[model samples]
Target: MKNYLFLFLCLLTQNLFSQENVDKKALKKEYFTTAEIDVKPEFPGGGEKMYSFIAKNYKIPESKEKIIGKIYIVFIVETDGSILDVKITKDIGHGTGEEAIRVIKMFPKWKPGEKNGEKVRVQYQIPISIN
Candidate 1:
């Protein structure tokens, strides 16, 4: 009986502090993090796995020119092994922005970040270089 009472109080306290509004950038900082391409992995599909996935699935909107350039895309890998809040921090100005977003959205859910072993939201970034 005493244990149940303590548990209830703990739950109530946690509920009160849990913020409903989530800041994506701040959340990213809280999760286990790394930035910049550690090693230029010639990963299958241009080294940007997500981009590759996008290319594999998303048909580049038939609105781009024939100029090949690097498209810099920044996106969140998401805690549930999914991609979210994707955007082109820099655009090459040939419909690549739209294409980058399309590829990110197609990714499946990912392992959510953990804070002290608890599942938490995360923000991740990836850069796509289209040659």
Candidate 2:
């Protein structure tokens, strides 16, 4: 009888710990934009490196007329510094929008923004110029 009681108590303790873990995981985090953040997200190597990456990776599509314009893109920098939800706000023509998106997707993870000393997700915008 004593052995059975000990086994039952161990099972109960294990179940309680598992339930606590599940509860913690159920708390999903929310994302915010730079307008709402105290600290802005940054590229791993800073702004200059980000621009250099774009300049090196961006390729102008073949077209009859030279494509020269700017493409605006917005993406979410998550709490873990991974990018998500990339969108193009403005696009010129000749596959410029797609090219911009492709290049942005190639960007490495950035330093996540912070709010009240905690890492937070932030929406970031960038304008790519094609000439």
Candidate 3:
């Protein structure tokens, strides 16, 4: 009976510890949007290179209406420096927003953001213009 009780207690303790670890992992996956982070994520070769990449890769969809405005793309820079959840927060019509998303998705991994000296996932946004 004592041995059974000891085994049960050990199992219970392990379950609790496992639960804590799961919670920690969930927290780590959460992306921060606030400007309070110690460092912001950046492109590998800086803003100019990023823009150049976009200019080289961005494809404007042929539209009868002639799309001519700025679209905003938002995404999460993961702790590992890869991007996730690409979205167009604001956009002009004619497939421009989707084009922007595609260009952003093709981008290489960025320098991950940091908070409290630890690498963290961060929300980032950029604007693209269609002429």
Q: What TM-score, over all chains together, does every model reach? A: 0.53, 0.76, 0.78
| Candidate 1 runs further than 4 Å off | 1-51, 58-65
lDDT by residue for model 3 over 1-131, one digit each (tens)?
Answer: 99999999999999999999999988765788749699999999999999999999998999878778899999999989898999999989888888888889999999999999999889999888777
On TM-score, the candidate that comes out on top is 3
On the 0 to 100 scale, the lDDT of residue 105 in model 2 is 89
Clashing pairs in 2: none
The C-alpha lDDT values of all candidates are 0.59, 0.90, 0.90
Residue-level lDDT tens digits of model 1 in 23-96: 44455554334333232212234436645575677554454466566666655554455656787887776677
* Model 3 residue 110 distance off true place after TM-score fit, in angstroms: 0.6
Over 4 Å off, model 3: 1-29
- What CA root-mean-square deviation does each model show from the true structure? 8.4, 5.1, 3.0
